[model samples]
Target: MRNPLAAGAATGVLVFFVCFYTKLLNPTSLPAEPANQVARSINAEDTGNNRMHANANAHISWQCLSESDLRDSINSTENVIVVMPAKAAGTSLKTFAKSCNPNTTENLQTLLSKNDAFNLLTKSWDMPGVYASHFWVPTALSQLLRSISRHTLVVYIHREETSRFTSAALHVLTQWCAHGPPKAQKNFFDKVENNNHKCHVREKKLVEILKDRPQEMQMGTIELLTCETYSSIEEYAPNMLFVDYKRANVLQNLLAERYCPKMTNHSHHIGKGAEKVFVQLQNGGTEVSLSEWLEKKSSYLEWTLGLNDKASCLVQTRTMEDNLSTCDGSFIHAQAVLNY
Candidate 1:
């Protein structure tokens, strides 16, 4: 009774669509490329020990790269990707990258597909160098490490988790107050109290905003991100270095000696005048020892940062007597402990 040819064609169309949608039609296997191919391709041109190109683009800013630029950079075998996140000595690293023959990008999703990523690393044999922001995106980080030459030196800059959080929170507050009404700005410190219902509501809003990002890009504690990044680098890249944010100056000098020997030293830009403001906010209305203030907010701080209770003891023990120097001192001490 039914038309056999029409029924058969309909079934075929449905099967094809299913295969296409499920990626069953796409090739699942790719020829394994030697990691040395990437290194050889990138190092084909010996730019001398000082890799800084005289005519290297110097229009450095905290801007993401264009899609076209990103494609070109990742595909080009010449660039070394630098993954530094916000409030993690990014400005200093940016300066370092710009000083070298490095292409910088902030777009985290530039290379999303595995095939394209593989081709980008294996195909291109020409490029000066690249320095890009990976932030804390796990998938992108994995793909990036896999695509780069095994010999490519991957760099990561990290800060102490608690100090980083405090700085980041203060930065957010500063930005919010800058654009907010004068009255609201004046009351900003008061609003930070957990007992304030409005503050609690704002915290919820912040969490929701963070939750809206891609799972890999979700806001995480600095410790968690650092651990993940370290693990990934260990698995993928053999040649890599982790820079401490506190000793960024030392790392900057070392990086210059290795990559841009001729480059001049540039001081870190952020957190210059922030220490005073940070002290004020943390102390609230009254003067208190760094240990006392931190101890008072121990529970809230631990919960907010997803830290273990023992972390409070470490924080308290490490707290400096002088409030003025405590913020900076704590950062240095934290890095020393980690690096030790």
Candidate 2:
């Protein structure tokens, strides 16, 4: 069908051009170069401002809680939550936390909202909590009494790309070794097992096993961290600390000291533990450890950050990570609260 709006727009543009040639625009209508430049500048400013507003609006996927309501929750509890990307020591940290998350395996993978989430975390009026990863947390370290999220401390642990992916791969193998394989992977795994023997197969074989939903491999860990920290830092930086996890343990240690002082951290030592997987990939003529599954990490980041094939965007991401540092004192500016 013909588009009347497009036809009308074309006709109007042609008429305007004819008028410019015949009637000649008035100086008021068509200003001088300086005035035109000023007009363009003003229009550009308006367009940019509108774009930012649209971006902010697009980001808020959930109905947000009011600042006052969030603050009331924060004020009621000095809750702590230890969050980390999947396989990034979150399981270990969770063992130490007095969790408020629903007691189910699903809660380990669910992201909750302010209305549904913080109520549980702050439920123990006398006892605060550290709801380990996968629970939606709005807080990052900002000045107390400012933003709802700022009041609560979010301890985000950072790990290298390969280590995180390797750990994920290990978790899958561990589970598969114990339980044959989850239902999702049962088909491929059954066929593969008919041919091969154990989880000591190449990552190509394994990623293929969990091919239906490869994200379950990364486990939403990177996505959760990127969304929370990036959005928070975008809003709270300069006035906030964007400290990488290595710089933690100051606050983590303080929190640890306050709670589990005599604890022995046995799992602090790092190892791939999946030597067969790493050996298979490294020996695959690429000489890179777990290089086959590195593609999973790359593709996952592309999906998460929308940074697919853009070297500049990758550089920008790295620069942001490089900018993190510890801040003992940073004020929370609740002027704007982006979604958690």
Instruction: Give the clash count for each candidate.
Output: 2, 3
Candidate 2 lDDT (Cα, whole model)?
0.43
TM-score of each: 0.46, 0.51
Best by TM-score: 2
lDDT of 2 by residue, 96-203 (tens): 553322242224224243225444444454444445553333222211112435545544455554455555655656556556665665543322332433434444
Relative to the true structure, candidate 2 has a C-alpha RMSD (angstroms) of: 12.3
Model 2: lowest-lDDT 10 consecutive positions: 325-334
